[model samples]
Target: MRLGIIIGSVRDGRFGEGVAQWFIPLAQESAAAAGDEVSIEVIDLKDFDLPVLTSATVPGAANKQYVDERVQRWSAAIDACDGFVFITPEYNHGVPGGFKNAFDSLGSEWAEKPVAFVSYGAEKGIRSVEHWRAIVSNFHMVDVRTQLAFSVFEDVDEQGSVAPTDSHADRARALVGDLISITGRLVTTR
Candidate 1:
């Protein structure tokens, strides 16, 4: 199984990178323990610089025929993954606009895939994760309930770095395990 860990924040000093850096290795370890051949990759939203939804056709009907080069690349990247882990930051009790735009730019690529969330912010980004659940449902994506959230006040340091607790590591393992298990079952249907 190929898993894409999407860094959904693109701010200049976003904390999502730190979270991804911490989570990736742990996820790999969990996959190894599960005895599944999972290949993981980081899909940074910053690399794509995707524009807001501007194509003439709706994403679901576009058939992956996006005119924008960046969107096309984004589509290809998402299409290659069997499942995803979205590392996001909460902005004003919701998901970052750029992240939501990046998500809206794809359709069938996300269909039937499993997804997990790891979010950070004032409220541990739980509200953002909750909002994401409704949006991903539009693509019929299966979102795992085992999420890992980090509070800005508690899980971050003075240098604006992530300082996850030991318990967070256990949550990461459980999230990855659930994602892998669900992806294994769902990928067959796709």
Candidate 2:
């Protein structure tokens, strides 16, 4: 299975990337050691300067298109994945706009893919997960039921790595397993 983790926020002080950096590699390593041959990638929205939608652009997902080179590159990278793990942060009770814009740039890229989330924030990032799951579903993707929800006020350290909590780490590992399983099943159908 080709699994991609989309780092959800591109804000100046965002902690999302650090979390993704730790988890993506661990997932790859665990899969490798287990001989499951899972392939993982991280998709960062900052690489694609997808602007807020303008009045000049087309309106619906079917007609929407990328107007920037970054968005095009973003699509190419996303096109390589069979599933996703969205590392998200909760902001003002919702998801950040950058990730949403990245998703909007290409309508067909997400269909039939499976997705999972590792969301964190002051409020544990659960709202962000719910929001992302709905959006993924709208795009005709299946979001695995299991997820890793970390509280910004709790689990993460200043360095971006999760603190040494066996239970939390176990949950993360379980979520990754679920992601791999769902992705494998979905990809075969595709």
Candidate 3:
């Protein structure tokens, strides 16, 4: 299965990239151990500079008429993936505006796909996850209940690097394993 590790933060000096870097290899190893052939791709929101929603037509699971080229590109990427792992940072107890905007840009590509989250922040970014859970459900995406939440103060090192300990790896393994299992079933059915 093609799994997208979407970097959900676009802020300067964001910690999302480091978390993503740490999680990718762990996910790969876990999937390999499970005898699942999975391809992990990093989809950074920064690459697609999707503007905030200003369209008259509301984007939904059935609507795919995106006027912007960037939106189109983002949509295509999502369409190619069988599942997703979102690396998110909490901003004011919610998801980053850019990450939310990227989702708003296009629609339907996420339907019936499995999504997991690896979030890091002061509060482990659980609030962001809560917000995303409610939102992604609108697109009919199945979310894995097993998620990895990294506390910035605990999981991240003083040098601003994601220095995950053994426990973190175990959590990632569970999350990735669940993602692979769920995606495998969903991909075949979809």
Candidate 4:
């Protein structure tokens, strides 16, 4: 399965990149254990030049006309992926605006895909992810049960490196295993 690991934060000094770096190898190992072919791609929201919803076309609209080439490329990337792992940071108890807009920019590309979360914040970013879960469910995305949440104060270092507790490895393994299992099942059905 083609898995897109989305970096959900785009601000200066964000810790998402380090988390994603830590996640890729675990995801790969989990897929290998299951005898599944997994290609992991890191999708950074900062790389996309997405404008806030100024286009007349909404994402789920029929015959959607994208505002520009960047949006098209973003949609294409999402369409190519079978599942996703979103690494997010809790900001003011919500997801970053850019991450939300990225989701709003495209529609059916996310439909029927399994989405998991690896979030960090003062207390594991659970509030932000709770909102995200509700939103993605509206898009018909399958929520992987094993979510990896880290407390920024505890899991990240001053150098902006991810230094998760030893127990987090087991949680990450569970998250990846669930992602592989759910995505594999969905792939067979598709």
Best by TM-score: 1
Lowest lDDT block of 10, candidate 4: 56-65
Model 1, which residues run further than 4 Å from truth?
none
At residue 160, candidate 3 shows an lDDT of 72
Residue pairs with backbone overlap in model 4: none
- Tens-place lDDT per residue, model 4, 51-88, is 78778767888344586888888888899999999998
Cα lDDT listed for each candidate: 0.91, 0.76, 0.86, 0.85
Ranking by lDDT: 1, 3, 4, 2
lDDT of each residue in 1-190, candidate 1, tens digit only: 8999999999997778888888889988887888747888889999998988988898989998899999999999999999999999999889899999999998899998989999988889999999999999999999999999988788877887777889999889999989999999987888
Output the better candidate (1/3) by lDDT: 1
| Candidate 2 clash pair list | 121-152
Look at candidate 1 and give me any clashing residue pairs: none
- Candidate 3 lDDT, tens digit per residue, 1-190? 8999898888888888788888888887876787747888878889988878787777774366678777878888988899999998999999888888888777788889999988888999999999999989987999999988888888868887888788888888999889999999988999
2 against 3, candidate with superior lDDT? 3
Q: Candidate 3 vs. truth: CA RMSD? A: 1.6
What's model 4's lDDT at 14? 77
Give the distance in Å from residue 100's predicted Cα in candidate 3 to where it truly belongs.
Answer: 0.8
Models 1 onward score TM values of 0.96, 0.88, 0.93, 0.93
lDDT score at residue 128, model 2, on the 0-100 scale: 87
Q: Please give, for residues 82-128, the per-residue lDDT of candidate 2 as tens digits.
A: 98888888878887777787776676778889888888888888998
Better of 2 and 4 by TM-score: 4
